[model samples]
Target: MKSTGDSKETFWKEYEKLPDAIKEALFSEENFKIVSDICEANGITSDESKSKLMKYVGKTLMGKLPIKDFFVTLELEMDMETNKAKAISREIDRKIFSGLRIALNKIYSTNIAENKIVSDNKRNKDGTEIPMPSKNEYKDPYKEPLI
Candidate 1:
């Protein structure tokens, strides 16, 4: 198990190992514009929306947060409707997640060809495997109650 600082350092080291083109695409203005469009479409005028979106994007990129959790966070923290949040998540998946997946796959294949250790799972600082949230834990905000 590593401390938070150690884990962050390791993450940054791995991030730096990625190709320059991949890094550039990950932080490109197009991606930023997509986030801004989402905020603006949802009538979120506050700068906080952009800040929170970027924060979640960073966590998602680092594999510290799941996309589902990002949707939940956006719905809760930004006062967004569930459908709007889900649409935003889908847009992000289409625009950002696909590119990230391709880049990661390329990196993974290269690492494998070089016989480098590739971790299959992310763990907590205590060395425990990070568990996915149950459906009950992430109930849809707009879901109707059962009779």
Candidate 2:
């Protein structure tokens, strides 16, 4: 696996190749919600919270950083602006991760899906085939009356 810094670098390199509309979407408010939730959950209150979170956009998508740790890192990296942010609940945590995953997929769906298709084909090539289901396994409970 690549080092965190390397993965982050890779993320930015790919990020730069994205269209301007995608770049705008990357900074969109819904995307920011993931970072905001992470910060709140980890008790990181800061005006710069979102900006700090932005720095790891690449690492998170690259899987170099766990989602929670990504937030924790942001918390550690940013100066706090307040202490009133609420802790993230488990449900909220799920939602935040779901949202991030969706957003990242939207941004890199083609590349991500291409990799998956290639890997799946390789695995199938190297593995045994699954058996097809047998037909006519069940018997009818009642027979029709003879004319």
Candidate 3:
């Protein structure tokens, strides 16, 4: 598996290969706003939200998680004042990004679990299960050390 830096580099490389129209659509303002809103809800400041949004957006695009889950619509709406056209979108659900955050968290937890030496199925080197001794089998260690 590639490290995050490698994956990030690969994502950007792939992003650069996309057509201008596709790139523009994928990184549209609606998506940015979604990212910013997510960051703000999680206590990230407005100043840092843009960069963080870009990072997560890149991850989402690169990871290829369900885009439909995050965004509901991508229609053009005319601005009432200038009568100019603008992209209007609605997020289907906020839980989508929250779920993505959870998915990413699982990645970290999985790594930790994988690196652990202990297994869930505990056993001794003699191929026998290491069972907890009963209280009656215990000795008073402070009085005398057990041999």
Best by TM-score: 1
1-147 per-residue lDDT for model 2 (tens digits): 569989779768887766554565566776577667666667656757546565565455544455556445543554333232223323334654455565555545655565564322222465865454355764556967679
Provide the lDDT at 123 for model 3.
83
Q: Residue 55 in model 3: shift from native, Å?
A: 0.6
Rank ordering of all candidates by lDDT, starting from the highest:
1, 2, 3
User: Which ranges in model 1 have alpha carbons more than 4 Å from their true place?
Assistant: 1-11, 17-22, 104-147
Question: Which candidate model has the greater lDDT, 1 or 3?
Answer: 1
lDDT of each: 0.75, 0.54, 0.47
Question: How far is 19's C-alpha from truth in model 3 (Å)?
Answer: 9.5
Q: Is candidate 1 or candidate 2 better by lDDT?
A: 1
lDDT of 1: 0.75
Better of 2 and 3 by lDDT: 2
lDDT of 2 at 131: 50
lDDT: worst 10-residue window of model 1: 59-68
Number of clashes in every candidate structure?
0, 2, 0
lDDT of 1 by residue, 12-124 (tens): 88778776655776577887888888778767668877878877876666545655587898789778899988888888778787778866566656665777556666799
lDDT of 3 by residue, 40-132 (tens): 654446565447445534545443433442222111111112211011112313433443445444444554576668645568899887776
